[model samples]
Target: MAGTHGIHVHGDVEGSQVVVGDHNVVINAALGSSVSVRSEGPPPTRRRTRPAGRALPDRAPQLLGRDRELAALERWLGQGYPVQVYGPPGTGKSVLLRRYAADAATSGRDVVYLPAAGVPAEDLVQELFHACYETENYKPEPARVRRLMGSVRALLVIDDFQGSTAELAELMDAAPGCDVLLATAERHTWDEGRALRLEGLQEEPALALFGEELRRPLRDEEYEAARRLVTAVRGHPLTLVQAAADTTFEVDEDARVTGLANGLSDAASVLLRLLDALSPLPLSAKLLPILAGGVDKAAITELTSLALIGSSGTGYRTTGRVAHLVAERTGPARDAAKLAPALTAWAAATTATRHDIAAEAPVVCHVLAAAAHARDHAAVCALARTTAPALARSLRWGAWHQVLDLGAAAARALGSAADEAYFRQEEEVRKRALGVVALATAGGALAAGGVIGHIAGTAGHGGAAAGKTGFAAAASNPAAITAAVAALVVGGVFAGLATAGDGQPRARPTPSGQVTSLAATGTRPPDPISTAPRPLTRPPSPSRTSPRPPTKATAPPSPTLITSSPPTDPGQGPVSCPLAGGTLTLGAPAGGEATDDYAWQAFKECDDERTLTVDKTDPDHAAFGVTPTSCPKTAHPGQYIPASGPCVYTVRFHPPQSAEPGTQYQAHVIMRDDWGRLSMKVSVYGTVSAASTAGPSSTGPVVTGAACVCSPVRMPRRTQRF
Candidate 1:
């Protein structure tokens, strides 16, 4: 039986029996082989063949915009790994899988394509098993099916596999080593596979598809309309294919298509109905508006299960199919309106929980009057007041302000005067909040004196405060007043001693025993008598005198000469003397060391001589008077070097005053080194004022000098020696 190519048998044959029944003959019987002639049953009915011109439906490579997906399928096929392709409908998952399978078959690889959609689970398993074992007109048993699956180097493509049930799991488990490609409208629950999500075709691909299928170039306007339609439909291949087939553009004599491509609304309706049929739940007329609120991924997935929406990866959108069906049967506008009251009621009831109500209501209300008519005062107010603060705190200032305005308006409309009063009271709370901020700022200022400049500049210069009024007001509170007093005390302690009359202009004393004359050559001089006097001094000059005196017969009148010389130093004791020159330069020994502490005490001397006296009478003055009269080799105590001036003086002996001595008759001078070490004192002296000698000269020396002469000398411009 296995060797015979063409023969018929009517009865069961045992061994090699050749049996002829009614219209036949029997031949050789044994030999384990026999040539049997048997009457054949009536010829089987033949299938009618197509005419010469007709051919079998040729399924060409259908893949579009799926090159990457095909490559992935090839990789999985090579590895004998099962792969599941998933995405929203119209992404061409099935087409891609089938095309890959065809390509593999053309490359000498065996492939079996199965459509799982609507097929019974048992039947699908059976068909898969048959494809695995049977080949080239051979029948396969269950054992052969199992063995074939283990060894076969072929791929199986399952299209629309989302409908597969648990029964199909056995077939999957049996073909663990065999390659399987699954195409589904949604991701599957299969455990032993990787899922590749497919995105919708892009605009360029869609346009190419349109051009290829339509066999004509789309006009500019038609192309634009197509693009809009495709984008709105998320470039869904199925929808684009339908739209491309249905739409046509032609240029008339006026260069316009007779009718423009349909609007999105029209196309959306058709897609909508298809989606409805594919949905898990029967979408009632009630839920359409809610789904349309925003056709995002989450919304689409939700509505898809409810039979109200569909989407592709370009993004979820309303369907023209559903829109049109409703329009054709239930008056487009009227059917759409039916959703209004229900959506409005839903919105109103759910407003308290829906954070997005404000954003959604306006659009929903446009389609459904009930949305506008529904009262949501509480919701609006809650959004405005509570949410606004949260937004502000989150630093969404613009959004916070918008929400506040919205809430304020809602509150005004829905709330009574009492509500307004409550808000006004809340304003006080806000002010108090501002006060807290101000207090914090103040505390910072107190911690760091740098903020003092800002505060003083504001208060003293009358600039506006940095913080809000409440903060400023809080800073001005009684607590702040005490703080201010404490700060003032602290500042005063740091500022040092401030003398009351120190900055005032007053008369200065002159050196004691100082004689000044307005008639003296050079600049006129000032009085040197007052306690705080200011005196002027001049350069030394030799006295003018005649060289001879007549002596022969008559006695020459006694010559009287006014002689001027440097003041005399009276040893270690304070000395008093009249000044001759307008200037006096006290020269101390180069390195003379003295412990003499001295302070000048000016007193009115002879008035006619316009003389004043400086005496170191007290112990303090004596202590300051011990400077060496002659130059010495050692360092001398510092002296008060008075401005160049003629002055009278009284000398006394005392120890040098310590540093920071005030009102001590002795001099106190301290010098610091760059390294902060103390250095030996240099000679220094105090100045004294004298009476003016600018007017008509009197008998005695006129005192005060001209302003320029009495004033302190202008420092000379020193040349740069380098």
Candidate 2:
């Protein structure tokens, strides 16, 4: 028979209404039409009710540790708004939502509770319509549905909302004014809707729940253990409740719980299997390996939709939880261990090329290392070999240097001829790589120098020479060349060792008969180097002239010269001479005069054989003169004068002079300052004359006067300036 809107019925069609105590039956005659049946089997009868204590309504158990959830639910109900309680499975979310709905209904608020699990999209809508609308003759027209929802302040509670169809998601979006209370195993994201995450009970409340259930306070250690179990299971309410039930509490010693909360994955696995048995499509075999290979939450969600696995989280974890559960049931520790080895093998089998080798090598090595940690030596070796030859070579080097502790045996196992070849090829490439580096370095140096030279307006030839010499030295030393090559190879290899092989060799060094000279013939001579000069010996004195005698009209020469008494022994002190007239009237010298003085004396003594001469003069005197008077009694005193005296007297004795320029000499002179403050002066002058002539042709008489005088013989002017 055909129903309204061309919906066909194969068996029977009943009017949309059904009474509680009626025989409900119908027969259809034609498509798009319905017939009603009048008749009966025994009149419908109500089943016998058990005594009040014997049976209870099939409502969810009383919610524990859900005060916050209930308050939130009541607030939403009062506002006539929808609420979704989302959390991982076993979080007491469904029970809490139900209790809230019941409470709201008791407060005279309209509330409908529906289980969304296994409900078809159409049936779910129908149920919502039936629960909220009071009329028995109602059809689900969109406008009527809207009008009914708009007229009432009602809360619709949906349990297991994640199991609903996409159409339900649409219905939720369309129902603007209707309030909804939803409980889900996972969080839902709906536009303009709020999702309240229902987490597991906190420590205190959870413990209280246990205390209330068990009729005793939980021991400290047992409470701690429960916390750990809860954390491990991510605090799913069902698991904690089960664990609380299974726990044994004692005084002093904490309660001990086993299994359910302790091994969440295992417990969840049991739940998943039950779900799978009920589900129309069983999880796929291929999916298990993928999930076992460390599938994340998003991947798991997609897998769940495909009936590959079951999950709970908002993202990938829908299938992820199921996979974890499966892993737990299969031996969590063993399953976790197996993952690394499987991943290692997969990576090894897949990554074979050298391109992206550095990138791929690290990933492969990580897998291998993880496998090694899991004690899967075969997998480690398999993955290690999959590493590019260049990378393997580096690994060997690392092993040799003790940087990495790939066991010696394993290192030896990994050492292959291919790796050696790859290393040698790398070294060869490095050697060739230097040519470009050398050229670039040379270019950079030249450019830098050119800039500097331009700024200074002078090029440094020496710098150019140094650069050339460096280039030559680098080319000549095999060790230096090898080191450069090694550095480049190592650097580039780490940067990324391309898959391409080394190119063909270029020109080789050859001996040439025609020699090209590098001699710097036209180069400018280097600057002259000089040493500091030594100090001079005798500096020449300035030429001087004697002052002329003063006329009568001129002031009389000052007679202030006062001579000290001569020594008793003539040789002991400076020779003394009496002035020709009273005191000598000396005047200042005409030109630059010598500022210092010295005195001299000569002595003769009669000895047994003959008169022996004892000359006593200033140690610095040039020469000394002596005159002896005829001895009246055969012992006469010698008349002496200073060697450089103004008076020249005949003398029988002579002394030799040294050839050195600065030798000492002594002389006498009458000196005076024109200014009377320093009147007529009497002093001895020491002259260190240039080396004296050995023989004199003629000698002029020495002038003796009070006026100052220079040496008698006039020589060309010899005034010397410093």
Could you tell me every candidate's TM-score relative to the true structure?
0.28, 0.31
RMSD of 1: 46.9
Q: Which stretches of candidate 1 lie above 4 Å from their native place?
A: 1-58, 132-145, 248-722
Top model number, TM-score: 2
Q: Residue 471 of candidate 2: its Cα lDDT?
A: 39
Candidate 1, residues 1-722, lDDT tens digits: the string is 21112222221123322211112222221212223334432122221121111111124445556666666555433322356776555455656765666666565555566655433343344455545432221212222234344444446667666343233343454453446777655454332234566665667776777676666887776777767655655555655554454453221211111121222244344435333332322232333445455334443443343222333221233333432333244223323333444444554553433324322322232332222234455545543343332222222222433444444555677865654444443333233322322432232232222112223322222222221232334334656534543453233211211111211112221221112111111111212111110111111111111212223221222212222222233232211111111111121221221222211111011111111122221112233332223211111211111111112222222223232222112222222111121111112232211222121112211111000000011101000000
Error of 2 at 316 (Å): 27
Stretch of 10 with least lDDT, candidate 1: 705-714
Candidate 2 Cα misplacement greater than 4 A, ranges? 1-64, 134-139, 163-166, 173-177, 213-215, 248-276, 279-722
**Model 2 C-alpha lDDT per residue in residues 532-558, reported as the tens digit of each score:** 010111111111112223333322222
Question: How much lDDT does each candidate structure score?
Answer: 0.33, 0.33
Displacement of the residue 57 alpha carbon in candidate 2, Å: 7.0
